[model samples]
Target chain A: MPPTSIKSRFGSRIRSLRDDRGFSQEELAERAGLHRNYVGGVERGERNIALENIVKLAKALSIPTRDLFTDFP
Target chain B: MPPTSIKSRFGSRIRSLRDDRGFSQEELAERAGLHRNYVGGVERGERNIALENIVKLAKALSIPTRDLFTDFP
Candidate 1:
């Protein structure tokens, strides 16, 4: 099995959680205090998320920061 | 209850993990491809960690990146 890339792993996990929470990308971005384009890049695995942003996402979701970084499957 | 600050949470988590592995700050920094000063700042809750660096640290520790972001009770 191929080792999962961090970008893909992070992207899929965030997208899944966002969808589960009924948040559109733009909505999530607003909550996380990030740009919509940046959020799109992250969901598409095109950008590297920063730790500060991760914290923001966690706070916005009312979850632990680890929730954003979880490995799916 | 006072909400734990993100800097403190992240700093403590990384320090605990590093200590558990018996790696010095310098050694961990080398493994994570970050500067010693940067790692020190992180451990001291004085730096904002980036996602790429988070990935690097996780890979160095042989743990999932989310492991670094966990909230310790």
Candidate 2:
């Protein structure tokens, strides 16, 4: 599979987790101290998000960083 | 704690995993299709490595991506 596939999967995982937490994109962005547009892009699989950002998002979502990779094939 | 601390811990984790696998920095970089310098920077906690690269490294190490975050505190 192409590299982007992994990104897309990761993005989807983030989106689903955000949804589970009932966090809107803006809410998640604020919690993670990121731009809303950036969070939206991540949800859409348009960004190759860095590890720091991943940690930020995981912290905002109150989940372990490894949770972000859960269910990934 | 500073954000760099997380990066530093992550770098140490990667470095230890690489060592455990008996892979040199150059070998791991080549396997992950990354630059040796980039891998070195990551191992030294100087790089905010992106998800694609993280996936590459995990694959190179023959471990699930979640394993990269193992023992992360």
Candidate 3:
């Protein structure tokens, strides 16, 4: 929407998923061993995280890491 | 090691990527329109972000969304 990067796009998706599940950043972070701020950055498409964390994120979020890219390019 | 979730895995990935790029959570958040805490959550593998956000994250991180899952299951 804003000529965003992968981070921004992923950030939007993350927010949607979180909202769909009625989860707060803090709640998700607690379960994922992550910081709420990091979740926010991801939602806003502001990060460049690595692979291992991707798996960690998928597990914590109850989604597969591949799911994060279910519709990726 | 912790049977971590996707969020945790992704969170770890994010941290590694950020560390690799020599960036702090705050720096990435500012660029991605995300909250730094949220970025931290993702790096710690704590969130179930959506596909779109994944793209944004990958972009912000200068990676392809598909690459996010380059080593995913």
Best by TM-score: 2
lDDT of 2 by residue, A1-73 (tens): 5455877888899899999989899999999999999999998889999998999998999988988897654
TM-score of chain A of 3: 0.83
**What does candidate 1 score on TM?**
0.80
lDDT of each: 0.80, 0.90, 0.70
Q: Of the candidates shown, which would achieve the greatest lDDT relative to the real structure?
A: 2
Query: What CAPRI class is candidate 3?
Result: incorrect
Q: Write the per-residue lDDT of candidate 1 for residues A1-73, one digit (tens) a residue.
A: 9986677778787888899899999999999889989988888878777677777777766787777766632
- Model 1: per-residue lDDT, tens digit, B1-73? 9986677778888888999999999999999899999999988888777777888888877898767765632
How accurately is candidate 2 docked according to DockQ? 0.69
Q: Given candidate 2, what's the lDDT at residue A70?
A: 75
Task: Give model 3's clash tally.
Answer: 87
Best candidate according to DockQ: 2
Question: What would the per-residue lDDT of candidate 2 be over residues B3-63, giving only the tens digit for each residue?
Answer: 5477788899999999999999999999999999999999999999999899999999999
Q: Write the per-residue lDDT of candidate 3 for residues B19-48, one digit (tens) a residue.
A: 888888899887667888878877766767
Backbone Cα, N, C clashes tallied per candidate: 0, 0, 87
When just chain B is superposed on the true chain B, each candidate scores a TM-score of: 0.88, 0.91, 0.84
Encode model 3's per-residue lDDT on A26-68: one tens digit a residue: 9877777888898777777777765545555667778766677
* Clash pairs detected, candidate 2: none
